[model samples]
Structures are given as structure tokens and as C-alpha cells.
Target: MADIERHDYDVIVIGAGGAGLRAAIEARSRGLRTAVVCKSLFGKAHTVMAEGGIAASMGNVNSRDNWQVHYRDTMRGGKFLNNWRMAELHAKEAPQRVWELETYGALFDRTPEGKISQRNFGGHEYPRLAHVGDRTGLELIRTLQQKIVSLQQEDHAEHGDYEARLRVYPECTVTELLLDEGRIAGAFAYWRENGRFLRLEAPTVVLATGGIGKSFKVTSNSWEYTGDGHALALRAGANLIDMEFVQFHPTGMVYPPSVKGILVTESVRGDGGVLRDAEGRRFMFDYVPEVFKGSYADSEQEADGWYSDPDNNRRPPELLPRDEVARAINSEVKEGRGSPHGGVYLDVASRLPAEEIARRLPSMHHQFKELADVDITAESMEVGPTCHYVMGGVEVDPDTAASGVAGLFAAGEAAGGMHGSNRLGGNSLGDLLVFGKRAGAGAAEYVAGLGARPEVSQADVEAAEQRALRPFEESGSAAAQHPYALHGELQQVMNELVGIIRRGEEMSSALDELAELKDRAGHMAVFEGNRQFNPAWHLTLDVANMLLVSECVARAALRRTESRGGHTRDDHPGMDATWRRRQLVCEHRDGAVTVTERTHPPMRRDLLELFDITELRKYFTADELGEVTAEL
Candidate 1:
């Protein structure tokens, strides 16, 4: 309608991170024309920032490790609220995904026996993470990008064009998902560099955009993660499950204001680092809750012994799941046992030799040295809770990765129910590999069965263009609100009230604040400048998405009335078994975000048998257990 560039493909993928890349690879390999769009440079997706390894039950480091153990640990780590089917598939298939990466030329760190080496992480019974030092995410992204390039090379050799079947559009942002009669028809996006509108008409779409950490004041997420995919799915009429459960990673940098909230990888603890307070006391032992009591060591001697002979001793309490550890750090700071920078001390110097620390965690060593000017191999580093991951996202079919909408699918952090409430440290990478492939394959199958391809409407394209230009129209007006100021206020509201620990009253206040922010966002404007590379214009779009998704989070958090994994309530401090059986589903209706309670399907009987009845009792209601036993 407006002379916009338009292209047609079988599948359009949003967010060129680990999930997006893997999904594109799968779809292209299946002989489908795939387009990948990203908000950053081709290889600079947020996946590169991941320091921990990918979780897979390879059993190279420990013979005791297998899919069942990994599955049990994952369910336990999620406090038993996970989608059992998704967790089962992830645990069973993760090893194959990791091995498949090797076929694509990934070189993981190997054991002395010349097998892929797996390392120990929180919530897992044995060494299970396949890694490359502490920069495992970088290697995964590198491998996937290489695979995509190889495909492009093959296409060039045959068709005289490198992008014959697959192409990547970097520095582009999708502002709206166009629908045709309740099915995904296409997407409307704008190039960030030139600020030009483009339309991608496709029968199916895969959303792999990560999380919503940028909505909070302090977070480990990069600026690209503003709930883009989540907001898009909701606006396209898909339901989001567990929007209240946001993960605050236990160890983010807390010193040096500029570097605060940068992630300190869980690799530090996996490689024998410990947590201490200002008085040099190992305080994590006191924070282990009853459900995890027997699984963790009670004494320093026992914990230290486990590092050498893990078969005989329990894991150190410092290696507890992220939610528990984050809460402990929050308590220490509140009680004045914090370091000078208002955080606890994460110490590796006393536990491992300097060279060993460097060898195991090179990225962490360099990150601390350069970002905080601290030598992690010589002293303890100040660390605290920082918003990192969101366990809530688009509700999808466990096998197909299909959302409620016919042609829409989601994977990785943008899809919910895989992690339930809290994700294990290494599971995020595994999720991208496992589910990304599923979504790509699923989309291909859907495309194959389609009777007619959905068409992008000209009216919808014009509306999207008008919406993108509204900020410019509001510029220089007397009542215009600066996008930066509005964004800062939104982040402050989320970080303070609806953060790691929550209360009903605070969340109610957050809802009120979000309502006001939404009104102000309607008048948002940027500084006078050309659209090309205009940061204020970019943030104006991001702020709108953040406002919509933030309201989903606040509304769901206020409704959930229980403490479990990532969704901890201060007023209701104990995990509720009944609540475990229910899920909070968020959907946009009549121009407002509304959350409704829904019961998740029961775990399959075979999966239920993997857990001890006593362990199941901790999270399952009596009636649910009866169903489990009856089904068995």
C-alpha cells in the first residue's frame, strides 16, 4: 500500500537467537523457504551472553546420569509444576540434540577418555552439562550459525544465490503479527537501521524471542529482550501461561553501578565455588528448605567431600536451585550480612586453584577482571539476585510447539510450561536445541498440509505503518511523554514491587502504576531526529510491548497467592500443593490483559513413577496423588 518491501516464505521466524537459528536450520533442511529476523547483528543475539553449559544427559562424566534422573531433577527443580510431557521430551531428547550439534562441527570440551564431557549443575544429580569452558552459549551459537552458512553455501552452489532457501534479516524489528481469520498470515516489521517498513507473508511463524528482563530496573538480560515475542503472541490472540514466574538468578554482579546485574555464570558454583557473607560464613546451609533437606549437605566437611566423592556425600547447599539461592541472598542483604556493595560474596579463590578456576571459567574470570576490576581467582566477588529468565510464555502443544492460534508456534524462553516455575541453569540452551527443532519441523508439517496459503491484507499493512509513525506525530507536542522517562518509570515499578519477592499489595500498586504508564505511552514521543538508527524511536516501540507484557506479569502475580520456585509471595511464604495443580493463563481481550485460572493436565503415570511418593507429596495434592496411583 505504501510501497513497502514485501517477501513470501513458508515460515517466518522472529528473534535470531539460539532457538530462532536452530528452528531456521530445521525448517530449511526440510526443504522449506525460511526467513529469520533479528533485532541485533547476525551472531550478536543474546544467546552469546550465556555462560553456563547446555544441559544434556550424556553420562560421560557420570555413569549414573540418564534421562530418568535428569527428568526427575528437572521436575523437582521446577517444584513439580512443569508440563510433564514437555519435560519428558526435553530430558529424553537433549542428549541427541547436543550430539547433533557435534555433527554440525561443534567442538565441546571432552573428557580424558575422549567423550563429550558433562559438568555438574544445580538440581541435577550428576555431571550433565556439555560445555566449552564457561562460554558454552557462544559455542552453541557459533555452531548453529556455521550450519546455517553451510546451507547457504550449498544453495549458492546450486541456485546462484546464497539465500535461495534460507535468509537472515538482521537489525530488523517486527512490530505486529498480521492474522487472517484467526490464523497467522504474516508479520509487519521495520528495519532498525533505515527505519523502512517490510512485510513477510508466510503460512506459519515461529517465535523465539527470549524474555522480559528489560522491564525490570536491574537485570541480566540485554536491551533486546523486551517481551517482543510474548506481546506479539498475546496481541495475535494466544494465551500465556505462568506469566508471574520470573527467575532472579542467584549470582549477578552487584558492585560497580555501571556493571550491576551482569550475570556471573552458574559455572562458578558448578566448578566448586561457594557463597559466603560479610563475616565469611557459609550461610547457604541454613537456607535449604525442608523439601530439599536430605539432598544437600548440612556441614562444610560433607560439602567439600562431595566435590571429590559425590557418590557418598550430598551436594553443597550453595548449589541449590536458583530461586532458593536468590532468596537466600536477598535475606542476607536485608539482615545486614551483605558485602559492602549490598550483596553476598561468591568465593572461588579458596575452593579451587587459580589456574583451575581460570581453566573452568575463563569467561567469568575475564568478565570480573574487566567489568568490576576484580580478580575472581584471588578474592570473593560481590553478587546478588538479578532478574534473568521468565518461566512464563506462550502456551503451546507439548509435542508440536503450536500455540492456540493455528499457524503460530513458540519455543525457548518465549514458550511456557517447559520449565514450569524455575528453570535449571543449563536447561535454557537445551530448550533452544530441543524445542527449536520441534517448532521448525512442526511448522513445516503445518505448511505441507495447508490447503491455501494465508495472504497479508493491505489494510493491516497500512495500519502497522501508521502505528509505527505515531511517535513522530507526537514529537514536539506540549503533552508528549519522553520514551526514555516512561521506560525508566516502568522498570522501576517492576524492579521494586513485582521483583524477586512479592506481596499482593505491592503488585496491586504495580497494576495501578502500569495502567497510568499505558495511558502515558499513548502520548510517547522521541527527540527530533531522522528515523534511521533513532534509539528513541526504537524504544518507543519497545516501551509499548513492555507495558503490555508487564501488566500480564503484574496481573498474574497478584492472582497467584502462593510461593513456588520463581513466583514467591512474601505474604504467602510456603508452596501450595493445590496451586501447583493450577496455572495462570493470560490473554488480551477487549483491549485489556486478563488472567484466568486453568488446571494443567496430570502428569503421565510412567513419569510419575520416576519420583518417590514422599517427594511427590511435597508438591502434589492428595487428590492428585490418588489420580497418579489410580492411573499407575
Candidate 2:
């Protein structure tokens, strides 16, 4: 008999990052019994590793910035391929979310006048991102965690309802969703500490499980980012959008194999740091033209002057949008003007006081000093692109956060449509809160009216259970593979064939490599010993998600013939107008992946008919054809 422990909750939330936690809080507020499950400790999700601030057009410092400007900047930053509704919602709700964070006891950095300080990020028309120095994510996560604890305590004392709602299950990993009939019913998972299976029965399931950065070799992402939510949604028949676009943050520490490439935080650039090649030449000015044309400055004097008067021009070098900076570094590295360490030098040491640098970037100091034995405050840090965030994920309506699948919902990096091609450095934190709330409400509302749990086949549960337990049964043989070895091979293959730049041949080869790795994974064996917190065992499952997500990426990348956003193909290097009309959505059906086209929403009639801002906002929509067709 199966060792089954069942739980019943009104709603089940997977992943305990900022998004999942926020969702749980909102669910409880709506009177639902909520349970938050995660693979790591409560505060240790990828959100804690986010170095930069949160994007919110608060206009605290720059009164010139508003949601309209924020919306335009976001659309342009995403290379005009973003879902307009999602972008609009994000721009409109982000400021209020940031304010909400403040109300929850988040202590943000204050300006001299004592208002929340805003900084410039890549692609913003005005200084807009509200930050707590470079550790904004750390602050954000800690504050949210504390608030949730407070709420749980209050709810317990006020109503004696502690046992019913707002549960946090750390170190537990969800293995499969239990779908009944055609809607979400619940999920099955196992605790990492002792390997006990736990089944949760809920009317609604929200996946805020973060990104798929672990699919690549040299990533700045944490080990927990295995595309769990994306993979789960796919198996559950949810649609995935823009899987071709993965963002590589430009300034990561590239040496020291143990830490590999740690994110160096974009705030370093926003705080007046500069990027220079080995020859000490600044090259961002050349590439900043088309994108930053009017907003950017050409000379050092002008760049420096703009820092003091950000309203007149952009602030700080290295603070440009992630895509531009990444491309510039790629170009420099390609031309052999890289630093001694094969990356460009990020020289924040020259601009800021030592005390200020240490205070603002405490994590950077700790990471470099502990891992690389380098004191960043005294020296220029060698940096380059590292896999950081996915701009593509399980596609959903931005407003509802509902997947094409009836009972599935997603938020955070797991659900795409907000950041079209490239994500700005500080925008993710605010995204988690805004969309988390929406997804929570969506899931709760769906559950409040849920009918009987759908029919779940015993065969389905058995298949998933068998797959989950396969690693424990495997034995060592000559042909037996090790998870780490297979993992390394997989990462190397993905990095080489589908990374930075792509070609049709390269993607095809990647698909073949993926096939081989997937086959080999079946023979893989976990290391002997206790299953308690066994990373190797966890990795075996992660590899499955990695392969599934990567295959989708390769398939989608091959289908898109034009270069746009973060997906650049040397063979097809320019954006195709026809390609801009629709988005490619990928779904897994009957155990095979299939692709379909989803038409972009028509330009809003109200916006199109408006006289003054029509043209400016029209760019936010896909180009117009006189007639409309349901088939994209």
C-alpha cells in the first residue's frame, strides 16, 4: 500500500518565494484555508538572491514619470512583443504594491527629503525603481516573511483559526498535480527531510515556483530554479508563451568554479558604476543610440551631468536595460577587448565612497570575499553575462493569471507575458507581489465556486508515483549514470547550443542532445545513503523538469525565424513584421509537445481613437491589419 498522508485545504500554493507567500496571505484574507509548499526553507527561495530593487513608478523623486510613461518604457524595453494587458496592469498596480510593502514594515532607502528613494534601471524613461540599496530583494523577502508570520499570529489569536488556514510547509517538494475530471483538484508531494509522500486536496492550485535557469550551465540562479511551475503547468495542459526568450544579466562574477557566476546586481550601475574594457575604453555610448536615442548622452561629461539631473537625461552608465548592456559586453568580448578574466571590468570603486559601497552592496561584498576572496570595495570586479531570469514561461491572461488549463494558475517568473523579451533588473520583486495577489484572488475565486473534484484515474497517480520513486530503485551498473554527471552534460549541451546566440542548426543539435540526455536520465542512479535532504535525489527530479522546459525552449526557438528580444539568431538577425502579429504557444498533449499560434489582442478602441496619445500607445499593440481573423 502507498504511504499516503492526505491534506485538505481550500487552496494550495506551490513555492514559497515572494509570490507564493504573498498569495498565501491574500488567500487567507479571502477566508480560504491556504497551504504554501516549497522546496527550501521559507526565506531561501530565489527571491532572496535577487540583488536589485523593485520597479514601481512611484514618482517619488521623478514627478515626470507616470504609469503611461512606465507602460511605454516597459513595452519598448520588451522590444514591443509584451502582452499589453499584462504590461498595463503591472505598470498601474506596481506603485500601489510598493506602497503596500511599506505598510507591511519594509524599510526602504529614503531620500534626503525622507521619501522613498527611486533609482534608474535599464529602459526606464525616468528614474522609477524603488530600492533598499542593492539588497532590495533580501529586504523585500524578509519584510514579507515577517508580515506573514504576524498575520498568522494575529489570525490565531483573533479567531482561534490557526489550524484551518495559512500553513507554510517548507522543505517539501510537489511531484504532481492531481487533476480530477478536467479541473485542478490537488497535488501530491514528498517531504525532503524524511521522504514521506503528502497529498494535498485543494480546489485551486497556484504555481509561483520561479524560473528555469538551472537548465543552463553558467547561471546566476539558485539551485532551486528548476522550472517546476513551468513543467507542472505543461503536464497539466497549460500553454507556455515566449519560451524562446531567456535573459542573461550582464555583470556576474565569472570565476571560481564553486560559486561559478554570482549576480553582481544592476544597482551597481544604477549607483554610478561604469563598465570598461581592458583598454579602459567605454563602449556603451556606441550601442546606446537606437534604444536610448533621445534619452541617452554621448560623452562622459554628459553622462555624468545626467546623473545629477536624471529628468533631463538617463542616469549612470551600466544602468541601461539588461539587453543593451549584455549585447555590448558580448560585442566587446567577441572583439577580444575583454578583461583579464574574460569579462569586462565593472568599476564602481572609482565612483562611490568605500563606506557607501559596503553599505549598499553588502551581499556583493560577502559573496566576493567568501567565494572568490576578492574585496570588491577596493578593486574593480570582473563580470559578464550569466543565466538569470526567464522572460518566457507558462502563458496566462495577465489579469487573471489563469492558464489555458481550467484549474491551473501561475505567477512570478513561472508565468510569462509581463516582460516580453528582456526583464529589467529590479522589476521582478514588484511583479511577484502584484501578480501574486492577482493569482491568489483568481485561484480563490475559482475555488469558491468549484464543483466536485474532477475524476482522477488510479493509473495517472500510479504513473506519477512510479516516476517519482524510480530514483530510489535504480542500482549501479556499467551503464548506470550518475545524476551529477548527466546534469553537467545537460547543462553544457544547453549552454553551447542554445545560449547567448542561436542558429537553426544549433537548436536542432540541441534538440538531439536533449533527447540523448533524457534517455540517459532513465539509467541515472542517486548516491547511496539516507534520502534525507539528499540533493542528488532532488536533482534527479530537477533534471526531468529541466529537460522538459529546455525541449520547449529549443522547439520554440527553432520555430521563431527572426531575432527579437533576448532571442537573437545570427542566421535570422532582424525582427520580422509578420512574426510580430502573433505569439507561439507551446503545449504538451498526449505526451507530445505541440505548437499553436495565439493572436495578439487588438489595439484598444478607446486608445486607438484618442487623438493626443494614440500613436504613442498604438506602438504598445501589434501592427494593424484592416480585417480581423480568429486564427492568428
Per-candidate clashes come to: 0, 6
List candidate 2 stretches off by more than 4 Å.
Answer: 158-161, 289-291, 314-317, 455-459, 476-479, 605-632
Candidate 2 collision pairs: 122-320, 122-321, 180-454, 180-455, 181-454, 181-455
RMSD for all candidates, in order, please.
1.1, 3.2
Per-residue lDDT tens digits of candidate 1, residues 147-250? 99999999999999999999999999999999999999999999999899999999899999999999999999999999999999999999999999999999
Q: What local distance difference test score does each model get?
A: 0.93, 0.82
TM-scores of all candidate predictions against the true structure: 0.99, 0.94
Candidate 2 steric clashes: 6
Per-residue lDDT, model 1, residue 448, is: 96
Which model scores highest in TM-score? Answer: 1
Q: Compare the candidates by lDDT and give the number of the best one.
A: 1
lDDT of 2 by residue, 1-632 (tens): 47767788888899989888888888888988889998999888889887778888888888878888887777777876788788888889999999999999999999889989998777776778788877888888898888878878877898787545788899999988888766887888989998777878887889999999988998989888988999999998888999999998888887765766789888778777889999888778877735455567778888888778745665544667787788789889989999877789888888889888888878887888888998878888889988888999888878878888777889999999898888876778888999999999998888877667565556676777788878877855566678898888889988999988889999999999988888888877776865677778888888888888999989989999987778888899876666766788889988777777877776555433322343333333333634222222
